[model samples]
Every structure is written in C-alpha cells, then in structure tokens.
Target: MFWKDKYEVGVELIDNQHKELFNRVEDFLKVIRSTTLGEKKAQKVNETLEFMKAYVVEHFRDEEEYQLKIGYPDYEKHKQIHDNMVSFVLEVSEEYEKSGYNDALIQKFAGRLLTWLINHVAAEDQKIADYAAKREGI
Candidate 1:
C-alpha cells in the first residue's frame, strides 16, 4: 500500500518489479510490527529477508540492463546507488543473524529500507523516466 502511481518510472518491467519490492517491504513491515515475537516473528522476518536478498539483486540487474539499453547517461551513478543498497542489505542481514535475529536490529533495518525504497522509487527512478521521455519524445 506504500506504493503510489507517481513512483512509476514508465518502464513496465521496472514498474512491476518496483511494485513487487514495495509489496514485499510492506509485508515485511507488517510481520515485524505484529504482536508476535520469538521464533514465530523471527521465522517470518527471516523468510522475508531471504526473499529480499535474492529479489533485490535480480531487480537491480534488470533495471541496470534497461538503463544500458537506453544509454542512460547516469547509468554508472545509478548502478553505484544500487550496489550500495545491495551491500547495505547484505551487511544488515549478516548483522541480524550474528545477533541471533535481534528484533531491534530488524526494526532499524525496516525503517531504513522504507526510507530508501520511497526515495529511490519516487525521486531517483523518476529521473530515468524523464530521460527516456526526452530521448524517445514520449
């Protein structure tokens, strides 16, 4: 439900993937915010984290490919942003596991994830659409 029409980048594939990411994150938030705790909560959080580990990489790869296809001038910069986010996610996942799936750690991670997702989709990704529109005269 955090996803909005304005966040779309006008690329069907990317838009769909973005929506999936939003949905996943929203589900993640719900799981973490629930009254459940201990093993049940950790199990749900781990599942969502694992899914994000794979899906985020896949989505970034696809998005980068699209950027290359369009010859987006800021492809390198965009990729760096993606790379940084991927690193952060991985790092946090590791920390969470090492901490025995600490609740506070995940709560912090969820907040950061939400902020990053919104900013990336709403602002950063919009630049891509704007460039494509200008390039293709859309």
Candidate 2:
C-alpha cells in the first residue's frame, strides 16, 4: 500500500523489490507500535532489523546493476547515494546493538528511513525511468 504509481521505475524487478521493502517497513512499524512484553518483542524487532540490513544491500546492488546496464549517466552519483544509505544503516544497526536494542534508536531510524525511501523512489529513482523513456522516444 505504500507504493504509488509515481514511484514506478519501469523496471519490474526493482519495482517489486521496492514493494517488498515497503511491506517490510510496514511490518516493522507495526512491531514498533505493539505493546508485546518480554522476549517476543525483542525477537520481532531483531528480525525486522536484520531483514532490512540485508535486503537494502541486495536491492541497492541490483538497482545499481540495472543503471549500469542502461548506461545511466548519473550512475556514479546514484551509487554514492546507495553507499551513503548503506553506511547509515550499518551505523544505526551498530548503535542499536550497542544500546541493547533500544526502541528509541530504531524509532529515529524509521523516521529517517521512511523519508529517504519516499524521496529516493519518487524523485531519484524516477529520474532513471524518465531517462529510459526519453531514450526510447516514448
């Protein structure tokens, strides 16, 4: 439900991955708001955290590959953006672990993440689609 037609990059695999990422983020938000007690709460949070760390890296790699395949002129800049996000995720993950899986930390992370995802997909990624369309004379 977080996906919008405006965010479509005209790439099936990447678009599907974006949807899955949104779904996972939704699930994470649900878990965050839940009042579950004890280890069950920690377990769910940990699972979502692990999933995001891995999935984002994989998704970025695939997206970068697609950009390279099409010879996107801004591929280098885009990859830099991807790297920055990965670094941020890792830094937050480390802080979360060091702080004993603090919910406050993840709450802040979620806010920044949602903002970045929306902007990246709706603006940055859309640039690729726009370029491709123009290239094809669509």
Model 2: runs farther than 4 Å from truth? 36-39
- Residue-pair clash count for candidate 1: 0
Assess the local accuracy of residue 117 in candidate 1 as a C-alpha lDDT between 0 and 100.
96
Shift of residue 32 alpha carbon in model 2, Å: 0.5
The residue-by-residue lDDT of candidate 1 on 33-73, one tens digit each, is 88855577788778878988999999999999998999899
How accurate locally is residue 93 in candidate 2, as Cα lDDT from 0 to 100?
80
lDDT of 2 at 77: 97
lDDT of 2 by residue, 86-122 (tens): 8888888888788876777878888888889889999
Clashes per candidate (backbone, < 3 Å): 0, 0
Model 1 residue 32 CA deviation in Å: 0.7
What is the alpha-carbon lDDT of model 1 when measured against the actual structure? 0.90
